[model samples]
Target chain A: MTVKELAEKMNLKIFCGETNLDRTIEGCYVSDLLSDVMGNAKSGMAWITLQTHQNVAAIASLKDLSCIILVKGFEPEEDTLQHAVEEEIPVLGTSQQTFETAGQVYQLIC
Target chain B: MVFEYPVQGGDFTNAGTVSSKVKKMMRQLGVDAGVIKRTIVALYEAEVNIVAHAYKGVITVQLDSDKIYIKLDDEGPGIPDINQAMQRGYSTASPEVREMGFGAGMGLPNIKANSDVLEVHSVVGKGTTVEITNNF
Candidate 1:
């Protein structure tokens, strides 16, 4: 599924990079722990989590994830946003819980 | 390119910066994806532990044709039990650290999983040294 479709399906707000919404998502990982997400989420996969921190962007960069979806409408710190912009990681915000977003992504990708 | 990061203690905000820089350097160096990724993940988790729990430390990264060598040295309270600390989900991080998407006790384990070679040495009340080499 494309990032745009996942956003619409999960009712997410585009914090940045609405242009790449049509990019295809290859996999999904739901985790707040950076270690687990990196170990489990393969590159080019979408990471769904409630974490919004600089470390999250750092992890995304290291893990080479396609994008990050912040569930439950969580707001990231300004530094986190800046880092995401610097690292070129597309970030999405959603009012849905982590499980809900996972379900939506599972339907689309799996 | 060679890189070195001075990790300050208790500064969760700056945690993982070294690993992040290493990620970019690996990409710029035209290293393969898996090798670049494995090194970054290994080094970053160790760096986070330094920032969160240790007194202070420095991380040095050197890239070569065959391997990326990373060394992390810190003056924090050393691990008393290497066997126990290596366990997944075993963390001494404070609650505040947990709230920041860390302290889930996966730092050491993750580092080991990502590196081709891993070695750790520590003395209680002294410090720790973590050396990781990821082969390309």
Candidate 2:
């Protein structure tokens, strides 16, 4: 499913990078640790995390992640949103926690 | 080609800038996708190390047809036990750094796992230098 489709299905808030919401999601990686995401996330996965910093956007870009889902109603920081906008990588949000979001996403994609 | 980028200590905002640039260059050069991914992962971890641990550092990248070589030289409190630091879950990062989702002790291991060759040289009081090479 594409990022837009997932957002719609999950009722996720699109914080930035609306232009690239059409990017395809190949898988999902749920991690709050930056190094874990950097080391293990696949190129096209949707990353679920509580990290709201600008480096979150940087890691998403470096790993070529399709989108970032901030869990538990968490939101991206201002600079994080700005970086996501500049990189055209969607920074998404949801009111659900990581486990619920991951389960739903897994059901949708898998 | 050769390129150099400077990294400042405690500069979380710009941590992955160099790796992003190098990834772009590799993609433009038509490097294999897998190779590019591994190189970027390794390079990014090394880059973050400088920002997390060192006062200042410089990354020198040499890109060739067969491989990409990256050397990070930093001025900071060097590692006294490279072996211990290489182990998983052996981070010495400050609480502030950990709060930012870094310093989980996975940085060097991640770098080693992604790179073909990983070399670390350091002196306790002075600094450290990390060398990473990945074959294309």
Candidate 3:
């Protein structure tokens, strides 16, 4: 599924990178740890996390993740949104907790 | 080609600036996506180390047809035990750093996993130097 499709299916909010919603999604990874995402997240995966910092965008870009999903209704910082726009990687949001959001994403992608 | 980028310690605001630039450079040079991915992962980890632990550091990158060599030399309190530091889940990052989702003790291991050749040398009172090589 594409990022837009996943967002629609999961009921996620697209805060930025609307231009990149067509990017393909191959998998899902849920983590707040930057290094863990860096070391393990695969290309084209949707990263579900509560990390709202700008560095999360860096990790998503570096690892080629498709999108970032902020759980628990957390909005990204201003810098984070800016980086998301710059990198053309979609920053998404959901009101559900990590486990629920991740499960939904997992079911959708897998 | 050779390039140098300086890193400031505790500069979380610009942690991945150097790596981002270098990644763009590598892409412009037509580096393979897989090789670039590995190289950037290793380089970014090293760059974050400078920001996390050192007072300051310089990242020197040398790119050639067959390989890319990166060296990071920092001035700060160095690692006393390279072996322990290499182990996963062993981090000395401040609480503030950890709160930012870094310093999980996986940085060096990730570097080692991604680089073709990884060399780390340090002196406790002086600083640390990390050299990473990734072949094209």
- Kindly report, for each predicted structure in the order presented, the TM-score of its chain A compared with the true chain A: 0.89, 0.98, 0.97
| lDDT, residue A24, model 2 | 94
Off by over 4 Å in 1: A19-22
Docking class for model 1 is medium
DockQ of each model against the real complex? 0.75, 0.95, 0.83
Question: Which wins on DockQ, candidate 1 or candidate 2?
Answer: 2
Tens-place lDDT per residue, model 1, B1-136, is: 4678899998877887787778778788799987887787788789888988898998888889878999999998999999999998899989898898788998899899988999999999989999999888
The whole-model C-alpha lDDT of candidate 1 against the native structure comes to 0.84
Fraction of native Cα contacts kept in each candidate?
Answer: 0.85, 0.97, 0.74
- Kindly list the per-residue Cα lDDT of model 1 for residues A5-58, writing each as its tens digit: 777877778777665567678898889987788667888799998888788887
Off by over 4 Å in 3: none
**Which ten residues in a row are the worst by lDDT in model 2 chain B?**
B9-18
For the predicted complex of model 2, DockQ is 0.95
lDDT of 2 by residue, B68-108 (tens): 99999999999999999999999999999999999999999
lDDT of 3 by residue, B1-136 (tens): 9999889999888999999998999999999999999999999999999999999999999999989999999999999999999999999999999999999999999999999999999998899999999999
Report model 2's interface C-alpha RMSD after superposition on the true interface residues.
0.5
Ranking by DockQ: 2, 3, 1
* lDDT value, residue A101 of candidate 3: 89
